[model samples]
Target: MRVPRRRRDAVEVNLTPLIDVVFLLLIFFMVSTTFETRQALELELPESVSGVAQVSSPVTVVVTAEGDYRLGQRALSADELASRLSDAAPQAREAGLVIEADGRAPHAAVVRVLDRAGALNIRRVRIATAEATHTEAERP
Candidate 1:
């Protein structure tokens, strides 16, 4: 008696089409995307356990524990800070403002700086602080 011939079953998990689609997508994104640059002006940014990625084009106002105010690295008085914020409002790229103060700085001082910044229609503000000085702290 002749035995019946068996047919091979079809393979189900086809990755070839998926791989081609993925590769094409990668190539398209690589060709069309522009990379953002890392700025060069350096300062020791305070570390945080829950800090988010720093935003681009922030107007940084720093206050020392002794009550000195700085715009980036340049110091500014209360009136000067207000004037600068008012002047720069028209040209600022971001509506967000970042004010970093030393640990010992008083809340009132921080409030004062923030109030003036608010007058210029700066809506978003954040306070920056270092991670609680834990030993063996690692960079995230």
Candidate 2:
């Protein structure tokens, strides 16, 4: 008598579960990630109803609550600020000037920076402000 042979079927893998798990992991990471802004100086900016977004990178001058001046991370005196503004006049004139004055910062300090920028012939000047909160805006 002759012996009979049986044929086997090819194996197949289902990848739907693996693809679902990968998509879940991607969504989890995207939801858990946080985006934060870092600044060289800590400032509590005043709230404003009509603040506009700046389009260009301009020369930034930070005035702290104690009325200290900081050009980038370096603290500068009144005279030093004038000299530095003079040195950066060309760039300032082109990109404009941005003054970030803390909410508690002295008015005199901000004025001095404005005066220096004016003398340097930097006409385009903007003051940095935060958006008004809902509660604050609702108050009379």
Candidate 3:
């Protein structure tokens, strides 16, 4: 007697479910992700050839063209700035103070900050400036 031969069928994987899952994940990430816009004062920094690297988390004083003062992101009056600097003397002495003054900022404002730093005896004070691209002679 002859034995009956068995027939085999080709196996296939269904990818519709996988494609649907991938699409769902992509949509979920797209919907859950957040986009934030940063609002800041547009400042043009003075150029210098001797600018050094900033300290780690130094006390930053921002002087605007309008002569407004910002101490580490908070706006402060001269009196408040003086008081705050006095209060932060110990830390500022160790880490230093960074003065980020706009190119068009008042000379008096910058001088005032420097004088305050001088009063505090904070020897590590630094003036922040952008790197100068042109030579001194090239500048008018």
Candidate 4:
């Protein structure tokens, strides 16, 4: 008598659970991530008819209407401002200094900052200003 041979079944892999696990991992990473935000000072720059575009990123010094001085959003005294400018002189010599003074700020304050920048031998100095609009011209 001849013995009957047993037939073998073809093996198959199920991918539904593998795809579900991958999607869960993606969602877990997306929900656990944190984003960083930068701090900035609120300012209203003076307007001018001949305002020019800035080419390089300069060290920004902000003078408020209340006569307060800020460098990169940190408040500092006149002496501190001078020291900071001197420390940054090498980089500023090429990148320049930008004075972002408020419109309501006193002229003397702006001039004082300019004088400080000059003392540091920073020749490339610019006063930040917005372009004058037709409405602004009509108002005055």
TM-score between candidate 1 and the true structure = 0.54
Model 2, 1-140: lDDT tens per residue? 99887877888898999999999999999999875333457899998878887774457888999998887657888889998888878988999888889999999999999998888789988899989885564788
State each model's C-alpha RMSD to the native.
Answer: 12.0, 5.9, 7.4, 5.8
Which is the leading candidate under TM-score? 4
Clashes of 4: 0
| lDDT, residue 134, candidate 3 | 90
The lDDT ranking, best first, is 3, 2, 4, 1
Q: Which portions of model 2 miss their true places by more than 4 Å?
A: 1-40, 135-137
lDDT of 3 by residue, 47-66 (tens): 98877766544587889998
lDDT of each: 0.71, 0.85, 0.85, 0.81
Q: Name the candidate, 1 or 3, with the larger lDDT value.
A: 3
Total clashes in model 2, counting residue pairs 3 or more apart in sequence or in different chains = 0
Give one digit per residue, the lDDT tens place, for model 4 in 93-137.
Answer: 788888889998888888888998888888989888888775654
For model 4, give the 10-residue run with minimal summed lDDT: 34-43
Candidate 1 local Cα displacement, residue 6, angstroms: 95
Which is the winner by TM-score between candidate 1 and candidate 2?
Answer: 2
lDDT of model 2, residue 62: 85
